[model samples]
Target: MLRELEKAEQKWGGANKAIDQWLNNRRNLLVHYCRIAGLPPYENGNSLPSVDNVRSFCEMLVDYVSEGHFEVYNQVVSACEKHGQTSKAVAQQLLPKINDTTDAALDFNDKYTEAADDKVLMQLDSDLSRLGDAMETRFQLEDQLLEVLHTRHS
Candidate 1:
């Protein structure tokens, strides 16, 4: 469990770094574009990025989603197995949620180019909101499983 936790932590850290880099690049791109175009960099509570911006965001987003599916979740499943928890059943429970997240991510990727429009941006917001809620549920499920493992082992 500890090893798996360590691996997951490392993957999460990598994702964090990637997000940071993407954000910095994105900021620079927007600033440069605005300067060249003689327009102020867009601000005013806009949530979604432009098509190019969303494309860049989706690159890192894909990375995170891939890690979540193959690395982090796999580690969690392995932890459950090593500790004799409901590895199989828990994985079954998690599969659809993971699939939902992955599918949503793919949808975002596909629509990212079209997301500059207000309607598309609104859809992106809705998709992202769902993704956020799904991730929270995953976190809670992992916490619950960890508590059970700790209680049994400790």
Candidate 2:
């Protein structure tokens, strides 16, 4: 995922301001996720992440998701409309999938954010795994949307 992010940054980093900033946030979000998920390099080898870490990750997660919907997705979709039918078709196809992932993300935020105590801690690992899958799906769909928009308009 980190490597994918680097490639995305290289591909679209200078393409648009909104996209660039969103990708940066994405990198931070991925790092926080890996830290919590205990996925190599960022792993603490611990069973569960600290409550503070979980709260921080949830905050970043929502910010990343919101920015994608409000800022980056809108820009890409607008560009798609300007290009042609094929681009529009790609965006339309991806939008629903992206929205599905958004629901998963918001659910994660809801579950973890209200965790004022460690009662949610028992299920944190499984929840993080599910959220990771959703995040990965979202990243792929978003990349596809950007690819269509940029390829057509470039």
Q: Candidate 1, residues 1-154: lDDT per residue as tens digits?
A: 2233344444333433533343344334334333322334444354445556656666765665675566655655665677665655666576676566566667766776455565666565566556446544544454444344344433
Evaluated at residue 41, the lDDT of candidate 1 is 42
lDDT of each: 0.52, 0.89
Clashing pairs in model 1, backbone N/Cα/C closer than 3 A: none
What CA RMSD would candidate 2 show? 1.1
Candidate 1, residue 8: Cα displacement in angstroms equals: 11
Q: Cα lDDT of model 1 overall?
A: 0.52
How high is the lDDT of residue 143 in model 1?
Answer: 43
Clashes of each: 0, 0
Candidate 2 weakest lDDT stretch, 10 residues: 40-49
- In model 2, pairs of residues that clash are none
Task: Write candidate 2's Cα lDDT for 126-150 as tens digits.
Answer: 9988888999999999999888877
Error of 1 at 9 (Å): 8.1
